[model samples]
Target: MTSPEVDFTRRNPTARPLTDKERDALDEFVDSIHYSSRYNDDHYEYRHVQLPKQMLKKIPKEYFEPSRGTLKLLWEEEWRGLGITQSLGWEHYEVHEPEPHILLFKRPMNYQPPAQH
Candidate 1:
């Protein structure tokens, strides 16, 4: 008989909390994957993340349909805090998915963030 597939998103039942050193290492790794500038310019810093087919399959079917608005909504959700302005923010940003399951995000590197409310 075949064993059930593992769901990676769920933490293992016997997992232990990260030690201080491990936490620091994880933080450094996260920083390394954050926004990176493609070109030396005042305009933008870019970053991207690729979703594997398994993860993409978990999303709703409508999100993958051929609609510009639906596509933008997906981008918006992925880019909520990166830098896009909605009602009260100074910085502007953009998102693109040039390839299936690949999301590219860019935001101005020179602009100051909006004041806290």
Candidate 2:
């Protein structure tokens, strides 16, 4: 299945830097989102990890998926929003949980942001 696209520019144009507390809140929110989404679904296991502030900055607030209870990291959001798919010669990105406190997101090898015109 394919993920949905989100217009980051329109969603969070000039998103301000989050404070330390907000960063923590984002982490907690991600956990809650994952848990709520997977609690009743046997196919998914709830898991979460702290991401660096730099990495998190690229993510749009709307990507948190509060309404649908899903987690959308920066790379996934970018991939979807840019309309680059595996069938379109775009490499797939992977979400990595290296440890309990670190979540790594690997961007597609050849992704280029859509030119703003």
Candidate 3:
């Protein structure tokens, strides 16, 4: 979805073009848009690791999935710096603690982002 500034530029090519900042803003906005429709049926490489009980202490409190008895870390706060995490989405993946000290990271196996023209 585009902002009003983008829409304005699109509707009026003859009008004033987007400023450098506006163009950068539009690029950032466009990058942030998740095209779910294009990736609704993505294939993921499911993998898990057994973490030492001590490592559990580092997990953020908000990530605990109490109902499932798991922790879901979809962003890059805790484990993104690791090589394994980088192979995963780096900024994506999940951590499920089906059992104590165990984590399952589900990442897209071969995700290809849509080409930008």
Candidate 4:
């Protein structure tokens, strides 16, 4: 079966297209994570284990992984951390970090942004 495609535009309808460097960084960041994907008829689901802080150092600072408070808000609001996903073209379905050094992320294949006028 074919891998699910990332609908970049759907991540943020009003956002501009990603620059080559931005795309490269995002690809690198995504690749660094250990992840697994499962596909159901409706959508693809992904679970990504957190990368070490040192590994994330190369990524842009704006995309700081997630703070505990931020993770709480994301769970309470059913929203992803925009800072982390802003350039990645993805959003978190769930986030759990039992300890400071360990984190787990769940994300759906599609990211649907609000309609833009």
TM-scores, all candidates, are 0.41, 0.24, 0.39, 0.32
- Candidate 4 — worst ten consecutive residues by lDDT sum? 73-82
Q: Give the local distance difference test score of model 2.
A: 0.35
Total colliding residue pairs, candidate 4:
0
lDDT of 4 by residue, 4-77 (tens): 44333222233233356755545544544544443333454444445545443443333333443212212211
* Model 3 quality (TM-score): 0.39
* Tens digits of lDDT, candidate 1, 44-74: 5445544443434434444443543222233
> Over the stretch 27-77, how does candidate 3's per-residue lDDT look in tens digits?
422322221211222455444555555444544444454665555443343
Candidate that beats the other on TM-score, 1 or 4, i.e. the better one: 1
Every candidate's lDDT: 0.37, 0.35, 0.39, 0.38
Clashes of 1: 0
lDDT of 2 by residue, 1-117 (tens): 233233343222332444556555455334222211111122222222344434444444564435433333334334334222222323222234333123322223344667769
Stretches of model 4 off by over 4 angstroms after superposition: 1-32, 37-46, 65-90, 99-117
Deviation (Å) of 75 in candidate 1: 4.6
lDDT score, candidate 1, position 44 = 54
